[model samples]
Target chain A: MSADLQLGASFRDPSGFVFRKNGVLLRQVNRPYLESLKRLTDSGLYGELTEAGLLIPHTEVGIENAFSDEAVAVLKPERISTISYPYEWCFSQLKDAALTTLRIQSIAMKHGMSLKDASAYNIQFHHGGPVFIDTLSFEPYDESSPWKPYRQFCQHFLAPLVLMSFVDIRLSRLAASYIDGIPLDLASSLSSSHTRFKPGIGMHLHLHARMQAKNADAGTKKETRGGFGKNALLGLIDSLQSTIEGLKWKPEGTEWADYYSDTNYSDAAMIAKHKLVAEYLGAVSPAPNIVWDLGANNGEFSAVSTSMGFQTVAWDIDPAAVEKNYLQRRADKLMLPLVQDLTNPSPSIGWALRERDSLIERGPANAMLVLALIHHLAIGNNVPLLEIASFLARAGEWLVIEFVPKDDSQVQRLLASREDVFPDYTQEQFEASFQGRFTVIKKDSVPGTVRTLYLMKRRAS
Target chain B: MKKLNRALNIALACGCLLTICQSANAYIDAGSGSYLLQILFAGLLGGLYFAKTAFGNLKAAVVRRASMHKSDDSASHVR
Candidate 1:
């Protein structure tokens, strides 16, 4: 393939970028980055890091044309795990990911190299913890350069962590709106009163921000400067490591972190629901099976697909819920469980919407489990039933979902505070609206609850 | 008749509960808010430990115990 492949968010990094050709994901390493690439591969550090689950492993593609100039190396990654932006990560996950990035940097520096940039997107969730994705992020240590990625590290990780720890966890949500990492000015404002005087947070965030502002006004940046020596660089990294250590946030709210206690399901019903989902997945047996469990509070149902040998994506809106899911996943060394708010899912916004894909653009899962979700989105969110049916239809071929009747206690509570305008939300009306998009395969009742589970397969148009 | 009554009561209670839970997820862990605060404090300490080099190496050692990150090289499947 030509070097001119169109990949929007991939254009910047001088090390090279990712592009897909004929369905295979490939990363092309540029000529200038050969030294760092050679050192990274030869150091034996890559294998050690990957096997420890601290790095994502890559395979060299077996194509004659894949390799360009002697300098360019084509690598085919086994799979793209979860594409969670920094904003989508729960407090613990973000904190853990930042640590992982810094650890990788420290190790790289030991090998006479360093990370050229500290973009959070370079870190991705894989087998529980965050792993380095950009194989090209490494560069030969230029002793004359003052650790160029320092400001970026602050923008992408440090400031956000400090603010979340000291001020409010919700402040971390600002990352979703600002793709260039969080604005330092905004972080300076959102930071807690105590953070203003905290040495590490103050120096890295407040003072560093002032320096950036002054530089902008002076019309001169690092362009004229030389890099820091060994002692200075180590000092910078050590101070950052200390500052990151000093900051913290504790997970709060029961359902966000511990969802099972208050969940309305009887133990028997929960097991039965999982059994039904398992049966439905075995029945459809779709190829390339990927399952997304929407509103998966703590990932109980999402694990069903993974246990059956399918990749599963567990999504929920609550950060606490995500934090809990990530904790469990880390304990078991599993690879699923992500944070999301379906109502306001991650969108593509950069130089163009085409820079990165929206959530829907990343999926066409083999199956989906919307267990006890429609009622929440329909009654709770006030989304129309017809639209809900249409959206779910595109998510998968075989969907095992639960329909909570208005008479069911959960639905009744949803109706209690508001007018019951959803007269058409009856089972008959639901079947009629969904029949156009799906074929009902089977339906079962939870042993103790009135919630009805429907196994529907998308009908070929 | 008794079974029907129990079911009815559960329905009524769950309905009210769901209605309330819809807005704010005010569910608490264990018992007192103070206990939850303690657990959170511990989690924060662990987060801090990770920032220090000691925690980083310890985590790697534990992960290497069973070669947890090992993946099959010869096997390739469609996703």
Candidate 2:
């Protein structure tokens, strides 16, 4: 197999590494981990977790599929359609992922196995809920040892959740900066004084940070104390679980969270817009397998694409809106709701800047829905219409976009706050700008509103 | 319940005393503090967990008994 086929993110784990062979993703289990892998299976942890949809199921492939001579076994795991990062998840999504990790840890202990790492990246939003994807994370449980992943779990999941809940929801973006996880020290420093009083936060964040600082210089002296018994470890997991479950962020106060109810669209116009979107989506030749609903407030329109059996991802900048959308579509296997700031989308980072893929690297989706979002980018953020058009062209092949005219109430509301510096922000100029990159396929005006919707295909180079 | 609480209090006190030693070790380099924290709180945490499990069992038993009593009443009415 070509060395270039190896995934950048899969190199951190020594037990196994995932690579692509003949375009099929395969994981090569190294010799050192063969015994642990056996224990994982023989202990029945793998079967139980996968059966409950808590773990990604994998099949052992032929040894000939190994990526290197160090390989002892090869396996092919289920592919997650879109790999999202912890930074891109909403408050509830991160909370759920944290709870899922703790749940998996507790279950693993029951079967004489434990997770060696608790990186949030190991969990993915698959089949409408979070599922642990790393099959090689399990190792033989050591009853006398404290949970090896205790610190990692706190950094990757607990710290971020606490910061988001008590401080500011926008602090979750810290995950993008600290890929290993937001440092406990940083989280502790940023936390409110009230958090210091909370038992879980006090112990896990504040006290944990202090301990790390106090022992920062201590050399590797052997732990000269009693063993951390099995009951103690279980208690640790239970405490983490209760702490996470107790933390909650109500999805309100954000401007866009109530966009649907606060919008100027009449009942007839809303229905017409939804109908037009479904019709335009259906008109795409050969049909799109994946659809991205950008600026998808509460995923009101994303449901149209999902209803048509296409895998749909609803991305909104506001955490409140995304949280609402996620809760509404939690059971819909075809729909995924995530938080994203399109202006500053997720960037490629980590070793050699290739470990985690940037937002654009994962896309050029089959189709993109840009409904009622142009004004926000053009007038609200001062991004030129041409630039917005070009960015969208690079993001997807087909575009179903709405052009809100200057007279539209939403555009007027946006213009209310700032100077109307956009003389070029007219409907004709919008069409002219987008037509350069996308050929206009069809256009229709909503019956009760002056806003126009267009079905456009990316122009051939 | 009182016995469980007493045991937990004793564990917490012991954990507080152990913190004075301040020396510990672990394989993972990033969180030496984490290892110490776990050692210090393990007893209290374990005692609390035991209490929680005991209370849960008590609640489950009460619910089961209530359901059985309701079933007996329904059976008498049916006869």
Candidate 3:
């Protein structure tokens, strides 16, 4: 596979397309967008936005580096360590992203510019916060024009947010199915009757959906006269901002959100486990640049990698846990916390299967921490130990895994209800299954607990 | 109350003009109904925003005046 490749998600906007040349990511600004680009820099909007950390900063490279003849300029943007989608973000992450977009729009308007689109995909978690990555999204403000991205904003940010707040948190996964945004109609239908009383929800979701259906066939191509004034546009942005602000999700009540408090490990064992993981991390040869902590409940152990200065991503299935982790690590620029269900992880989705990378496609991270998560997959989820080992082998190079025996209180709790059909879930079976794929480097029992932790290196294919 | 009434009137007028007046040159669809809703509510929303900002400025001015008075009294005492 070639190291230099054009990003699949970058082609939708005609202003420019992001591509890599000799492994360095660059965006080519087309001739049509040259004027907008000039206006952006000249008006000082770019400087203010980048300074505020609302927009991604980029440096203009020579036009000679253009991928195509139509390119007027090329930009070398500060690279994002990880590209996370809307679906992967927990409630607060998505809300924060939405708020960030609105803030940028307001600031752009002050500079006589406006955002061309309001796609959530344009927002990426960079430098510990959400940032607008699409430089081409800004255009010269038309005082008479309505906010063109209004519908898209509602669908992408507003609808999903309302649904998550009012309907169910799990409905956020609808973002994955509907690549553009969750359909407003679907969101409206799912919403409870009481949501209609809330002015913002009523207008944006229910009324907006009704209007869309009514005008589905209405010819919008014809030219006409009177315009949606600038004040109105500002008002619309403000209204959306307040509406989103009002929509809040408290990260509590979920099982894993309170995992550390409810754990069986003693204080000494907990401290020892943390120390052992750090020790194993230091022992890994050719220190890893990136570390992924799977099943990172509130990112307790992921902190070990972040403190060690490795770019770490904490993935947990619980939204509450991921939200808590995100809130706690807001200042850690090297850490990204996200929600992921290991059973059905994010897959390659969008226009083609290639538009968005699947969970595995993004990795084989330099190191992966599968701490206290084996039993859930093996016994609770009914996945075989061999399959679990095989998946983990493909996910990272150096594996730091904890094997929770059936006798462990947590594992026994899981088996308290279900029949224990898994006779092969022993520690001996686990080592046998993984030994084929990884070479064991270090093994130690966590001081006061029955749990065993191992550090292993991926065997060369 | 008068301002609110005027805003509502303007909104109603804009709603009436929705079918006749439309913007063009959008790359994305910018659905007809969505555009109409914005046009219809533009007057009321804009008025509300204007009123809110105006009230905020008024309150800030009052606070500034009171603070100035306090400083002037303190200076007089010093003299």
Candidate 4:
């Protein structure tokens, strides 16, 4: 019990390992990596990256609780509210991460250091865009050394982006199944013939896969290996930069991408709903720190929560809608948009089912925002009111939900296509089902509509 | 026995040429080879681009000088 619980995913790196103690996360730097660590900091690479907000800043802490004999230094990095994987990211998010990694590698090369690894998992969406989180990934650059992370970068960023853009956007989620990254051969195979004509795709993916296959089959090691000059390394980085920059994914219209434009709610009703939600948010004591906006289509309500200075996670099932939401999140904002269907969220994946967490593992946020979302979960999805209540109760300390009556055009539209089997889908049933788990403190019927917003606090045990 | 002796001699020569005949003491794989190939390609492509730019600049300079010489002759003749 005294041993610090080391993070499972961080064990791959021998230079340093992250551990948790007394609810605080700390990284223990090993003795063998001290020289490279010094080079990274002393060469001013650390300061430049941190100043530009491209790298996570850390403070060296006293090694009072050095977990192991190899611990040379302990660092406390800025805590990210939520750790989201690359698979959860949209096309642009993944693209930005790839470009950021390339930029880091270029800069590191200039400072006589290079990234030893280029896993997309090393990048995290912080403050609005991707930032490098792995401090131990850098090593002293050798002029003659080939970039060890080259193949990894291609698989992690280049292949996935190419597949997502040229083949299918949903193919980006393949990052979840292939943690190392989508294989190059698979990416090339999945892409269309047209993609082969694109310069970037042809060289980095198609030709790269062929080279990999050839190398694997030959099983030959060259006695006279070629050396890479600094210029050549920089040229490689530049090629990757242009290739990533040239790639683009236009947001295609989906079922919910333009939902707001065709909504039944009048302008006045929408305004009233926003106002009531704001008021309820103000009524909560001590002010909620984090809020999860479930089914936040294009993040209109999530924007409100963010404006109030709450770190908000905007979740939606529609890929296009989530993509649009992420595109609009400002660099200084507190919103993370993700594509997630509530019925089937991201499951525990990777080795031992602990490397990546399930959706519920990272949560129990300070508050939940369920505006215009309950109807879809209930009447549309056939989920019982009690089950929904129980799930919501486990998800947050406070719940702000909106009740859409069956007579409403939105609900009628949902029922229009399917059987109207949800007999207990009413306000009375909702309140009754939630009463055991939450205390309803405030309720208001939105003006100009039958929809009602309720502010409930999870009942104290 | 003669073939074996010849093979040993070749091995010794190769070892002598490659001085420091020990294991690499590092990790290098097919991916490393692929990366080296990329660097080679990038270097070639980049060098070609720089060469083209230099050639274009040289052509521009030569053309400008020729035009200047023609102007000078015309101006002198008019004087």
Candidate 5:
């Protein structure tokens, strides 16, 4: 077995590649990229972006243990806790990532450098905002050179954002299909003609797509002959910024978005639920370092977990709810709110299906919180209790879950539209099913509500 | 005759500029052309932004210098 394992997703760029050695991730900067790397560091742009938290910070390491003979230098970047795909991001998260990429590019220009790639995968949400993760994406800016990543930026950022805002918001799922981005042509066709009336859509999307179609017959050339000046590049970035800033997706009228406001829980009941969850978390041993709050509507409980010094990922099915949760995540919050339908989670995608990990591959978190969600998975989605327990068992070592009885108004509401064929959906059955997977540690009823919250540890395999 | 020659030269120059500006090889996609066109239109906006930032900086510098001079004057009087 080789000591170094190259990351599946980082094969495109010849300048550098990320690899793992003894489970420690490191980037080997190729010899060809040495000039660009020096320009990036010596130019002070790296320092500025890293200090501003716009770029991921890295430390240079000795190349004696390089992954390849052509290695110029090795870098160890602060690893992002969990890697998320663009398709999983809410409208606001994608927009923020796009704007962050363009902002970094503009700043790079000021320091006589430019971004070589505009792939959405290059940006990751860190702390409370998007941070550029690929350190080798920068190259020395030439006044005569056009921005090579312009087309990629439009495809990855502009097209998807336009489709989400103007067309159906669910069109963002197209990102999962087309890993590069939602194709410009598809985005242009999906959106109504009314979208052309918007500030940047007509020119950037419709016309741009047409141009791409016209030039489809042309062979790929690495460099186009043109003298694209610095001012022009800056102007392009400004236009993109304005276009993204102008686009907005309001989370209104969604059943989940209005969940907290329309819930049967009284103000006191809500507080009681929160308090019980906090207390249960405190009782857990070895303090969980990472937490996954499944069905975390607006991240109320996720925030509690974050406050307790845990890196929490708040997953919700509704884009609107996820967007709302993300909006509340300021600089102090450690929550990464993402849109994820528990029923159909994000799957392994890209070449060989291993380029991107499925939701489960990235998980088995230290602790998993499934609050007000069991009824939905069981009663709403028709998932068997035993299966749910098995799935949750694979998701975490400790599980803090709520079992909303059939009598609960929320569960009744779910049954209102469907036949009540859930014969084994009783509390006794729920506990029995979980017995095979989890050792129930404690169970308590939330005050003022007919809901039971249970804390359980995974049974030894 | 001279005016005619100058007109011909100007037309040839314009033709050359147009030819060079035509969307480059297959390497540069249509999206790049559309983006470049947008940049050409918004170049003035970028300039305006720089101008606004410059003016703000100038104002701050003037305010800082005036306050510093006033403090120096008070210090000398006290001495």
Candidate 6:
């Protein structure tokens, strides 16, 4: 109600909206949507999904909370971190989130509640599962709510998953361009000519979209008379399930997806480097709940944070690399792996900057793993070392960073193709540049490699 | 296989925490592997037990939570 906290095109949900205050994220439950929340919670649907780890959990903020003036009751989530979008996710990530949504919907129906919406953005990677985050997505099932979000589910989840599987791996990014989900009509047209008739795609994508537009334009804003009874709704869920099951993308051998199995590290080195991070993390007083491992090649180092129960994202650039990391994530159900090119990270786009949180908005990771990443940005990407220092200062309270010198074999290869113009790239220069922002606490080098690792803290506020 | 995956993930999560106890090896550790395997079997047994007898225990708990809300959007529609 503050008229702030507005972002993207979230204005369309007449049900309610999400907001944050004093470092806690909360969703406002308007006066009208009370019944749905009661129906959902009363029926045991919320409890089951939470215990199964399929949805984000919320605690009712006592009435005395500040926003009490506006909200019926404020809810505080356990933890909030980088909220990536559908377009940001690799194909497997989106597909998994999609399937998890369907699974939750099926579970909800069993207990006499139904998901009022199926937007992919509602699901997030939490504790190695696709957790639903929207507290306002519930409604009492009368066999007539018409799955008010049926069309939305098609546009948001099924359509994108299908397009990714059938058309191109990059099509998921189209979600950024069309926040309401890639328009079904547009998705139908852009889809390959052959897919228009593929039973699931034809009906759900091509024909269903045509029918929706036709019905929408038919001047009937009122709920339809078809009255989808419990049987019909369950039937619809089964239909969607089969459609999703039939749509599959066998992981194509991508360049980065196959990276970890092909890295230069030996067994001893991987273990040693991993231990180094754990040892570094062990020194911090209060356990940090979030960590960002920038340049997390296939997430080996980032795994340290998740192992400690901190929500972590292992960000690498190459889609193939991310795909490979994601494949392992799928096989292992690990939550730490994701693909991001540190040099050209994700940008906020959509209705307003609110649709997607900017990199800075989503960060400061409580701690960060900037190992082997500084040299890439400073030397390979031509970013000033001081700027890198400033960026890291704003990103985390504590940092476990690695600085590779020009003499390191990896640095040599990075500069092999470029000019040797980095005059101030010495170890002394590195310390001086970062010392302005960070108090270097402890510094050590790996047993075999000449790379230097330092644990530093940001200048106090 | 499904229960085994969850069991393995939880084990590896725990194992990663205890990584200091064992030296880093090139392959997965034997003791760690055995512990995770036992979890796999145990997790399966637990999953089955829950599947057959899930609804009763949490129904009352959920009702208690919902009653806290003064929602009007059919929140209490479920009996």
DockQ list for all candidates? 0.01, 0.33, 0.26, 0.08, 0.10, 0.01
Model 5 per-residue lDDT tens digits across residues B1-79: 3343334334323432342232223443444454444333443434534554466688789999999999999999999
Per-residue accuracy of model 4 over B4-68 as CA lDDT, tens digit each: 33343343233223321212223334474366355546455455335444666887899999999
Alpha carbon deviation, residue A98, candidate 4 (Å): 0.9
TM-score (0 to 1) for chain B of model 3: 0.60
Minimal lDDT window, size 10, model 2 chain A:
A218-227
TM-score of chain A of each: 0.92, 0.97, 0.97, 0.96, 0.97, 0.86
TM-score of each: 0.80, 0.93, 0.93, 0.87, 0.87, 0.75
Model 2 steric clash pairs: none
lDDT of 6 by residue, A1-461 (tens): 36335334355676666665654666667667777888778889989988988888888876555343545666676674567777767777877787788888889878877787788889887666578998788766655434556667778888888888888776776887787787766887788887754544555566555554444324332434343345545545544665677677765566545556765567887678888899888776577877888887777776677777667777777555566667776534435566566666667766656677667777888888898778889888899889999888887888999888888877888888989999999899999999999998889887578788899888986
Model 1, which residues run further than 4 Å from truth? Answer: A1-5, A67-71, A219-227, A254-258, B1-79
> For model 1, what is the alpha-carbon lDDT of residue A10?
78
Best by DockQ: 2
Q: What is the C-alpha lDDT of each candidate?
A: 0.69, 0.87, 0.87, 0.81, 0.82, 0.69
Give the residue spans of candidate 2 off by over 4 A.
A219-221, A224-226, B1-29, B69-79
Considering only N, C-alpha and C atoms within 3 Å, which residue pairs clash in candidate 3?
A: none
Clashing pairs in 4: none
- For model 5, residues A88-198, the per-residue Cα lDDT tens digits are 899999999999999999899889999988999998888878999999899888776556787788889888888888776777888989988777778878888777555
Runs off by more than 4 Å, candidate 5: A1-3, A219-224, B1-79
Model with the higher DockQ, candidate 4 or 6:
4
Instruction: Name model 3 segments beyond 4 Å from true.
Output: A1-3, A221-225, B1-30
Worst 10 residues of 4 chain A by lDDT: A216-225
On the 0 to 100 scale, the lDDT of residue A429 in model 1 is 80
DockQ of 3: 0.26
Query: Cα deviation of A218 in candidate 4 (Å)?
Result: 5.1
Candidate 6 residue runs with Cα over 4 Å from true position = A1-14, A66-71, A212-216, A227-229, A250-253, A326-334, A349-352, A416-421, B1-79
